[model samples]
Structure formats: C-alpha cells, structure tokens
Target: MSELIELFKDPYERRARLVPALLVALPLLVPLVCVYGPRNPILTAVLGLLGGCGALYALASVARGRGKKLEEALVKEWGGMPTTIALRHRDSTALDSVSKRRYHEAFSSKLGIGMPTAEEEAADPARADDVYIGATKRLRELTRGGRNLLLKENIAYGFHRNMLAMKPLGVVACVLGLAYGLIIAKALQLAPLTFAPGKIAAPGLAAALTLLISLAFFVAWVFYFDKDSVRRVGFVYAERLFECLPSLQPTMPRKRTTKSTASSDGPD
Candidate 1:
C-alpha cells in the first residue's frame, strides 16, 4: 500500500488520478447544488461523494501505470538493463538499434556496470548470456508479487471507466426514480417520506438507494462479463512482453535418437 501511494507521488501519475476525479465531480456538483444544496447540505454532500466515486478507479489506473514504470526504472537503476525488450515484443516502438545501444550504455554507466568489451562478448558468450539472463530474471522476480495487484488495478479501472461513461444515464435514472417515488409517496402520504427526532425532512434516501442499485449493476457487469475480456487484453500484452525476457522462455526437451537414426544424423 505504501508502494502504491509512492507511485502516485509522480507528477504524471497525479495528473492521471486528478483529471478523472474532476471530470466526474464537477458535473455531479452542479445538479446536487441546484436540487438539494438549498434544502439539505447533508444530503447534497452524500450525493457529492457518489458523484466523484469514479475518481477512485482513475487513481487506481495511475497507480498501476506508475508501478509499471517504477518496475522498469528499478531494473535500469540496478544494472542498466532495457526492460523494454519484453514489452516491445508485443508493443510497438520506433527506436532504432543505435538509440537503444546509446541508452543502454548511459543507463549501465549510471548504475556502475561499465561497458563490456568485444573480446569479452566473443570469448565468453555463455558468461554474457548468464549476466543478461540473471538481470532479467531478477527483474521478473522483483515484480512477480505485484502482478496480481496491477491486474486488479487495471481491471477495476476499466470498470470505473465504464461507470463514468454511464454516469449521465445513471444520474438521470436515479433522479427520475427518486422523483417518481416521492410523487407517489406524497400523493399517498406514505409515512410523510421522513423520519427524525424533529421535523427535519431527509429527502435523499430514495436517490441514494437508486444510485446504490445502479452502482451494483455496473459492478456486476464488470465482474461477470466485462472483466474477463478486459483482463485478456491486458494479459496478452503483458504475456508477450514477459516472454521476451530470456529467463521466461520455455526450453524444449531434445528427442532421443535410436542407434540407426543417430548413425544417419552424423555429418557426411
């Protein structure tokens, strides 16, 4: 959790988190103020909370994005490795080999892993492979625990994005449902639609209930149908990138050859 908070401390992350909250909150405030602000500050505030609910998901997305960047930054900071090798396998990049080489050199220098020699590369390819593979493996091990956390964050953010997109409809539905219920209650004088020690009439229960139901429906849709599809897209991208890591690739077993087959397999 502390790590998650630290991730959002970045300026880019803060922007990602804050923009969505403001987008959801501002429009929500207008209606709450116009309708209930004059009559009941308490109810208006409760509605205000619901209005900005989508912000939580946006912040979550920012955390995942930040975590991903931090994961790469750590690997580079440790050994000057390019974590993009894995990510680039699935994602597109326009960087040329020269730029990648220069970046790797500078990155390694900052981390105190001086440049390797052509003699070293040619003379001991296996040793160089070990070094690179170890670096990549360390990175994966460091990030493995956070994989589920990041996936949950991404999946949740997708759901929140859907909810925000449906906000106009949800808000309208809640308002209309409340209005209709109140009309019926008032006409039938259904228990005065109020309950308190004094004459303080609380009018937002119906709206709150309606909003709660809408939220539940949205959550269900995300969990049952939408989450799997969204998860698959994220999984595919991550899997492809992870596969690019040397240590993550699978090794195939060599087939045993019969004596006759072995004789035939020898060079002419």
Candidate 2:
C-alpha cells in the first residue's frame, strides 16, 4: 500500500482519484474507527494489513476510471471538451471573440499553423481538429513549467470532476451508514463512544455519530456537484493551459503527417 499511497504525491492523483476513493469508503471507516478507539492497536493492525493488501490502491484506480467515464459523457452533453471547444473558431462558450482571436494568433505564430478557419472547419473538420489538437498538446507541455498557472486549475478541475463522478456511490454509502446509525441508536440503545465525565466512553453512540457524520458527503454531493461544475473547472484549466503560448519558442515548421494524430488526453 505504501507503494500505491506514494502515487498521491501527484496532485492529480490525490485530488482527482484517491480522495474520492476515500470519501466513498468513509462510511465503513468511520464506524470502524469509532468502535475501536483511535489509539486501538487492533484497528491500527487492521489498517496496516489492509494498506499492505493494496485495497487503497484498487479503490483509487476504480475511482479514477469512473471519473474519466463521467467526463466523457459530460463532454458530449456540453458539445465538446473544454479545451477543444475553446480553441474552435465557432465556439463562444469558453472564450470571447477577442480572447479566442488572441489565442489563435499566439498558437499560430508559435506553432507555425493557423487556427483553422470557420470555412475549413465546415469543409474538412478533421483538418481543423488536427490543428486544435496539436495546439492543445503544446499548451499542456508549456503549462508544466514556470509558475504552473495551469497546474493549479488542473488540480481544482480534477478535484471537482472526481468528486462529482463518485457522488452516487458516496451518497449510497452514506445512506447505508445513516440507516445503520439509526438502528444502533434507536433499537440497540448503544453508545459507542458516549463520554460521561471520567466514565469510560461506550463505543455505540460515537460509532453512530460517525455514521451520521458521513452524511455530510451526501449533502455536499447534492448541493455542490453538477456536470456544469466539471465543465466550468475544465474551462478554467483550459484557459490557463492555452494562456502559456508565449512560452512556446518558434522553430522551423515540420511537415504535416498523414495520420490523424489527435488523441484524447485528460487530467488523470
């Protein structure tokens, strides 16, 4: 698990993948922690074994996959990927005409290829796509250095995107925990971690309270998440990414390739 946990050193991995995994897993973890006091040797051993078994690694991977799938669907609903849409001559949702024109000028000058005209987009869309795709690639490379203006936006985008992706599962886990909490509190009349002055705390009430606490995840999903939220964050990231065009130093232009080299890359 240490090996897998180390992956979180990457901002995208932590904000976009691992944190969502942990939120979905929170319901189960909360009760366990409450039932066994935070200092319990038994709980610590269980976690160590679980961590060694790569459970956390698997969870993070699953969350990443789901988040990406959600992103794909949202792209369709929103008409295009944020960066791709912003660079298009016809799309005005992500950038104003003045800003888009400046973006076109910057990339065209830097890359030695014009942003495809609206007529070109209408006539041979793939050619236009190739131009936009190439510019996006360059933007990503350029954004990696300097102050990393784009990196911050990318992390913010990933955080919202992944959190939105795992929302249903997170909500379901919270619902189950809430039900269990009610059961323990009402039927069992147990106080999992109830403290009374110097008295030893019972584990039931605190455990139930932890379950209730998990519902905050559900409420947040309901109140804070939406497909538009992902799109908005993505566009912000895209703008910052493209904003790096001055970072591109001009060189002799290479011949165009026959193949459509454009491929989908995202903030994994």
Candidate 3:
C-alpha cells in the first residue's frame, strides 16, 4: 500500500493514470470479450474502447487522490506563514521613498519586516506594506512559531479544497457510469448473441456489471475517504496552530493548596 501510494505522488506521470485505467478496463473487457466476441469482432472492439475510456477515468481518480495528499504534505512542510513583511506609507507618492528607506534600514540592521529588498517588487506585490510594529506580541499570540502555524493552516486549507473538488467528481462519475450501463444494456438488446451452446446468456452484461461495480467502489471511496481525510488533516493542523500561539493554549484551573492548622494539645 505504501509503495502504491508513493507511485501516486507524481500525478503528472502517465503511469499513475495508465495503471488504474488498466485495472478497471481489463476486468470489464475480459467479461465482454468472453460473452460477445465469438461472432462479432466489431461489438467486441466497441466494448473494449468503452472499457478503456472508463479505465482512464478510474486512473484519473487515483491520480487526483494522490495529488491531494502530496499537496497537503508540501503545505505542511513549508510552515505556511508570511516570511516577509510588506510595508507601505499612508501616501502613495511617498510609498517608494518610504519603502527604500525601510529596506535600507532593515538590510543594514537585519531588523524589522524581514524581506529581501530586491525581491519585494517581484513577490506578492498586492500585499499591503503596512507594518503594525506593536502587533508583534499579538501576532505571536495568533500564530506561534510564525511559519509553523501558517504551514499547518495552509495544509488544512489544501485538504479542504481537494475534498470539495473530489466530492463533485465522485458524483459525476457515478452518474455517468449509470448512464453508460443503461446505454450498454440497450445496445446488447439490439445485438444478437452467438455464445456456445448452454453458455452464459449475455456477454455485455459482464461489462455493464464491471462498470457498475467500479462506479460503486469509487462512490464509496469518495464518501469514506474525502471528508474524513479532510477533517483529520484539519484537526492535526489546528492542534499545531494552537501549539504555536501560546495565548490559544487552554488555561488549566489552579489547584488551591489549603494549609491545615495543627492544634497542639499540650501533654496529649
């Protein structure tokens, strides 16, 4: 399972999609060929083509799952917080001069909003350059360990976004599978079968069954994995976030230390 997951990490790789496509396509194709290919090569070819397409879609699903996992991991590793500070003066005309002065001061002292002066123009330019110097303590309270908390939040957000994308795709795949099954069933009824004497009644039935089963599996997978995975990722991310911000930590109730008065009884 670990190896399989590792293989999925590079979603851009064609193998990820190809493997799943084969898995689904082979099973469906086998049943269809056995049932329908004795006399009509054309029908068999058509079924194979359809099965192949379905297989490709199955592979895409696997790739999507892998991509989500990889995205989350990357976000977590980065510690997801703003590493640089952008500062802008109140007047637009004074912005460039103010920015240059601040940049020079920060570079000379290695203090205040830590961002490379050269890269400032190239980076997220839309980001406001307002520096709330007094908010350092509060910012620390909001995001502890600076980057670490931000990284977790970013990862959590990624998981949530991926889950949202998967939910819709799962629904669409299931619906398409149903429609495909109906179309195949109608096609089978129109075509005559030429199986060996006393053999199974229909060949196309197997393909339909395979598709339906795969569809069902995918739907179940989405429901079982997507939301729960996102929730788990979010929970861990939240814990990490809180750990960074000391103020977010829960205050334990203080235990009262009662001093007992010992009455000394003389000659007791």
Candidate 4:
C-alpha cells in the first residue's frame, strides 16, 4: 500500500476512479454512521482501521480494473475503438475521407511509420487495426502531462467511463441506503409531507434525507450513463489525441536502402 502511495497523487486515478468509488461507498456507510452516531469514537476507530488496512486503496484498484474491462467491452460493442475508428478509411463517423487522409499523413510523418493505406487496410483490416493501436499508444506517450489538452480529454473520458463502470455498485449502495432509510422512517411514523402540524425527530429527518439522496443518485445513474454517451466522450478524446500530431516534431523519413544503392557506392 505504501508503494502505491504515489498513486494517490495521480489526478486521473483520484478523479476518474476514486471519487466515483467514494460516492458508491458513502451511501453504504450511511447506515453504519446512523447506528454508531457521527461523533462516536468507535466509528472513527473502525474507519481508521479500514484505512490502515488498505481497504480504500483496494477498492480503487478494483474499480479501475473493472473500468478497464468495461471500456474494452464498450470498444468491442461499438465495432472498433475510437482511435482505430478514426484511423479507418471506412469509418465515416470518425472523419471525412479527405480529413482522415490528412490525419494519416500527419500521423505517418510525426510517428515515423507508414500509415495504413485504404487499399492495404481493405485487404487486411486486422493489420490496419494493429497499426492504429500502436500509433495511438505512441501519441499518448508523447502527449502525457498536466498541461496537455489531450490528457485533460483523456481524464474526462476516464471519469465518465469509470462512473458508468461503477454504476451497478452505486445502484446497490443506493438501494441499501434507501431501504434502511425507509425502514427507519416507517418505524418513527414520519410522513413525507406534513398535512397538519407534526414534529419529526432528528433521526426521521435524517433518514428521509438519506432516502432522497439515494434516489437522486439512482436517477443520475439511470439517465446520465449509457453506451452512446461513453462513445461520444471516447471519440472526443481520440480527436484530442489526434490534434496533438501538430505539436510533435516530425520524424526524419527513412532513407532508401536498396541493392541499387549498394552497387552505386564503392564496396566496403
């Protein structure tokens, strides 16, 4: 866990994975907090114990793993990855054919590799996909940093992707919280609306608030997350990545090395 302490400083990890994780985790903790009381030393000690044992770190790691898997699944569901789709000549959703041509030329120049030709890609689409994946990886390495707009776009995509990945767990936490809240409210004989003058205990009010919060989170997950939105963010990130091409210094073209050159030069 101490070795992973540096991970805490990574903005991508915190904002994209840890924050959503905590949102899901917090609702689950509400019931415990209610039972133990907010200022209870016992509750504080247990939290400390969990933190010391690296539970929170593990949760983030697990969430990140799931997010990655889900992202890959999404890419498959969408026919191809955003970057790959951008590189493909056939994917009109990615870019106009002329723009894609320009993009491929720039990428070939900057990345110091041959961009897949439409004819070649048509013959071997899988190989073309490999080339696109490699180019995207190189681009990411070249543009990695806080100041880069591409990195910001990457963070944005990651946040949405992970939030969607954590949606099921979030829903579970919301359900648990809502169930406990409703039970507590029913036991206390509290009405959601007051038709006449009635006093609600502090606990009843707290339970009702918890129910409302849980419902809000459930609604957000239901409405705000889906395949289309995630794909949109992915495309935006891919475009931002491609836009970094101009920033990279172009690689020198490889010189021709043919048998004719060997014959033209004096033998060593």
TM-score of each: 0.29, 0.83, 0.29, 0.83
- Give the distance in Å from residue 88's predicted Cα in candidate 4 to where it truly belongs: 0.8
Instruction: Residues 1-268, candidate 1: write the lDDT tens digits.
Output: 4544543564333443444334334334444554567889888777657535544545446444443444344434433223323212122242445544553343243322333344664575445434434433433443443455434443344333333433444455545444443442242234555523221143355434434444454444335433234334333433433333332333332111101211000010
Any runs in candidate 1 off by more than 4 Å, and if so which?
1-14, 45-92, 114-268
What are the lDDT figures for the candidates, one per model? 0.39, 0.72, 0.41, 0.71
Q: Between prediction 2 and prediction 3, which has the larger lDDT?
A: 2
Question: Candidate 1's C-alpha lDDT?
Answer: 0.39
Candidate with the greatest TM-score versus the true structure? 2
lDDT of 3 at 222: 62
lDDT-best of 1 and 2? 2
Over 4 Å off, model 3: 1-164, 187-206, 233-268
lDDT of 4 by residue, 162-239 (tens): 789898988888888877666666543335632221322444666767777788888888899777777888888878
Compared to the true structure, candidate 2 yields what TM-score?
0.83
Q: Name the 10 consecutive residues with the lowest summed lDDT in model 1.
A: 258-267
Instruction: Provide the lDDT at 226 for model 2.
Output: 80
Candidate 3 residue 197 Cα shift, in angstroms, is: 26
TM-score of 1: 0.29
Model 4 bad stretches (over 4 Å): 1-4, 187-205, 252-268
Q: After superposition on all CA atoms, what RMSD does each candidate show versus the true structure?
A: 16.9, 4.9, 19.9, 9.1
Ranking by lDDT: 2, 4, 3, 1
Tens digits of per-residue lDDT, candidate 3, 60-157, equal 56645654554455435532211112223232331355544543343223222332244553463333222222222223344534464455454444
Model 4 / residue 158 / CA error / Å: 1.7
